[model samples]
Target chain A: MKVLEAETYQAGEVHRFEAAGQEFVYLAPAGGIFGISAAAAAVLETMGAAGRRMDELRAEMRAAGFSAGDVEEALEELIEARVLERPRTLPPPRQKMPERFPLQSLVMNLTNQCNLSCKYCYEYGEDKVATPDGKPKFMDWETAKASVDFFLQDSAGRERLHITFFGGETLMNFPLLKKVVDYAEAAAGAQGRAVDFSLTTNATLLTPAIIGFLADKRIGVTVSIDGPPDMNKLRVFANGRPSYDVIAPKIRELLARHRTRPVGARVTLTAEVTDCIRIFRHLTEDLGFQEVGFAPVTSSQKNLVTIGSGKMDSILEQFCALADEYLAAALENRQHAFSNVTDTIAELHEGVNKSHPCGAALGLVGVGPSGDIAPCHRFVDSDTHKLGNVFTGIDRSKQADFLERGHIDAKYDCHTCWARPLCAGGCHHEAYVRYGDTGHPNLHYCDWIRTWTDKCLRVYGAIAAQNPGFLEHFERRKAS
Target chain B: MKHLRAVNRKAVRVAGEIDAAAADVHALQEGAPPQPKPVPHYPVGCTIVFSPGWEVDSSGGTAGLCQPAERDLYDCYATCFWPAQVPDHLNNYPDWTKKCASATKDWREIDLVFP
Candidate 1:
């Protein structure tokens, strides 16, 4: 028989909160949440900041009316869960940056020309990153084919590949887009690999034939629309006429025709477009979109359409209100198309700890119209962030510098932030636009992101306690 | 369940005692309270009773769970060993961990389904 010996234990970092009338702890070391018992809480409280030896802890538990066996069991459970630990063993090493990460997806920029002259347009407006001179406005077939073959070759052992059509307006080069899809499908099929296709379109050029083809191919679609006519005043044509009337009917046709995949709306939240709920309702209830996601416009601080810090409060409040609705819907096992909340909740469910702001330039990259490779879609035509050309292949030296600089370890401010795992110091493009350096953290978004992450954590906790089964459903939804 | 027994022995011991007591009371005119038998392992479809379980282990106990379940989640996804509960990343969601190389660390990079 083994004899239990007295040992000293130090408590691990934990974020304790109440959700759905249950006390829970977000165990930082383990990156998991567990509904702790009253006894467990008592044990932690008694242990306090200085921690306690086994003898002291056992005596305290006995005084608190817990049996010896129960006390030992709880201690074992807590220790095993990593809520308590031996005084000092070296902390686990940080995740090392992989020497060679595989490529899985690419954002193919079909064109650099759009009919709409949206005021907040990142690609063509006042904040434009100066589209490099002499590049083709519309992607030619040769460049498109090389891009496809580049993706196939780069993502060598990967069984599944993904291509996302992007642009100043993706559908501007619809003819080329069709040819590229056909060529990619046949090319991928020959290799016994599967390629998933999706596209972000401005919806002005969605003809009946295009819509039918999109539906048949089951291509995922994200339509760029702000809201109802009044809200979309910024999204106007070169003649300064609102594009709502033109795109509305076309979007409806596309939505009506595209049945194979869920259609989503991507709203650019600027200074004027702050009513998230109103916009979400208009797009989901009225426009019949399956999901609606919002991104605060990222550009230079002086840009007129930039979402100001003052207005961020309102945006966050509206987000919280919508999140409450999402929680309500989730409790009943129904999905609410408030995608911002949906995405954050999903991240929380998986206990996400990000190393970079996003998948950009990691598993995914962007191919510009002229076959120039960039970090992501937003950087497609930007001369500064050009990674390489599809023909010559990715410049690993430049790629390494970008990744190393963007890594969470390099972000000093993020080292102490609890939400770093989710934000990873915020978007790389946003950081570059705001601070002129991709390595810089988006300090402007720190408070907003922390508050938002906390709220999402609460929502995750509530759903977990009330309807854990729904999490399983959500997991399946994401996986499927 | 076997893995649970190996991972958390004490919990299984306590649970086994409880199960045995219940079995003794619920037995149908049994002699010597019928000794507890080990569950036989076999190749089965989505074997929830064999390996990693969510809430309850094969012993019908709470003690054998992976203390913080996230620790073993990626292993399960990678091997497709336990598909009764979680998605098998090997087949169903191959791109699930494309950005998340280290499940214990980079779980945030796991992709979510979007339109």
Candidate 2:
């Protein structure tokens, strides 16, 4: 906490806005937006444009007609909050990762072949084309086996581990999934470790047998469905017919059969659909999913149907509406049907502050259909971002490069952004897709994120105050 | 504006690590899930393997890390990767286990102290 000096001081990025007839300065670095007298807002506005000496600032404040006491108190408050701080020179960068890295998760891209061609699909969601590296569409069982072995061995010291089967559709390669499950179980048993299995599927290809198998093996499944038929216009069969009708019954069947573990519904929100509450209702209330989450379409490609600035406010408003519903349900000791609300609530319930948006290059690596390792599932098809191959092991330099790019300091704007800790430079892959540079943070959604987070914070405060017992449900949810 | 309170910040951390301990004791005594041992915070699906080979107490007052030797067959005394209590994310998160990938070490910490 640098104290503002009377001799000299620098103002960080302080966003000044007038909301609800009150003057406010949102100090981004401090994660505080304070309502101050209009005079104080004027002071911050002037000072924030450039660094200034204290006496010069006072003179400006006085000329602007602010009283000595108000100006003094305003400066005191700003300095106390670390909004105004001493300027400093940059320090040399240090190593961003450990020399001996710990491997905790292996995301296996079972195959690149998919039956459904969703418009928002990042992996050339355009066509059944070869991978960006021009590799074959399917992963060989041998490569998959080796990758599993590597994670179990490399992450041996870890008491528990997870293997996520990702792909064009994991069920597209059911045989490999089964074989890997058996092999992983045997391997974990030998290592005295526990391995949990999860998969993200489109639900177009799931049959009774596959659902039974997943339930039998206790593999958690997350079905990708936007909403009712009209909401999922972008998701279609390879032949270009809407897939909601075809996948809906399959999803219901999956929910009915996959009894061993909870089945979550994952909805991808594109520019076409910002009706969050409606989609959430259909997924959880209408469809009976245990939980449901939403991930906005991330590709910045011109051809993709990505969410734009126009829809973010409506999306945020709808999310807050659902959050209110989540609060109502939680206070009554009932589980909310909305996964997004529940997830944010859980984080707030637990006070989770993340520095990175996710565990991409750290312990979690996404193995492509071939033997290649990418930063995460999103980067699996991106050749440039490929960190290494499973058979060859991680290319420390490339992996380290991607990891370093994600370091908060490496991002120019993120260091000063109040949301840096949780946004973690936004999604690394999103940055790569948008700017063609992995180090950049996607500023496109920064406003939406900050606004959404603010809503979550408010929701947390309400639930914590009204229903303390609702938090106990965390234990039950964790157990369930 | 009121600042964030410390207690509210760390509420229900590791499901109150103590409550979990009590539940574990209750389960051993009642041979049922009397109270659930709080959920450990190693993300969902990850398990913690505690250190083994503990010296047990022959007497059975309470079977714990070193409580009752007779009841101490499986209870982990030393630390396990999966701590029973979740770290208080607000106050003491970014524990030794690992930092969330998004959290980078701020470079400013390396600068020399100035008067």
Q: Number of the top candidate by lDDT?
A: 1
* CAPRI-style docking class of model 1 based on DockQ: incorrect
* Model 2 docking grade: incorrect
What are the root-mean-square deviations of the candidates from the true structure over C-alphas?
A: 15.4, 16.3
Tens digits of lDDT, candidate 2, A1-480:
222345676665554444334454444443343445665566677686567888888888889888877777667556555456556676435434467667778899899888987887777744212255578688888898889877776685787788999997888899999999999988898878888899999998889998889999999898888998889998988788999888889988888778898799888888888788889889887888988888888766465476766776788888888877887787788877677777765654544445457888888999887778888887786667778787788888887777777777677776666656467778777787788777788888887887776666565555655676777766565544
**What is candidate 1's DockQ?**
0.02
> Model 2, which residues run further than 4 Å from truth?
A1-96, A125-134, A349-355, A472-480, B1-4, B7-115
TM-score, cand. 2 vs. native: 0.68
Please count the clashing residue pairs in each candidate, in the order shown. 3, 7
Best by DockQ: 2
For A63-133, candidate 1 gives per-residue lDDT tens digits of 98988776766676676666777776574677889888878899999988888898988787666664757
Best by TM-score: 1
Model 1: per-residue lDDT, tens digit, B14-84?
A: 34544454443222112223454565221122232123633334543333455433545665766765544
Query: What DockQ does each candidate score versus the true complex, computed on alpha carbons?
Result: 0.02, 0.04
How close is every model to the real structure, measured as TM-score?
0.77, 0.68
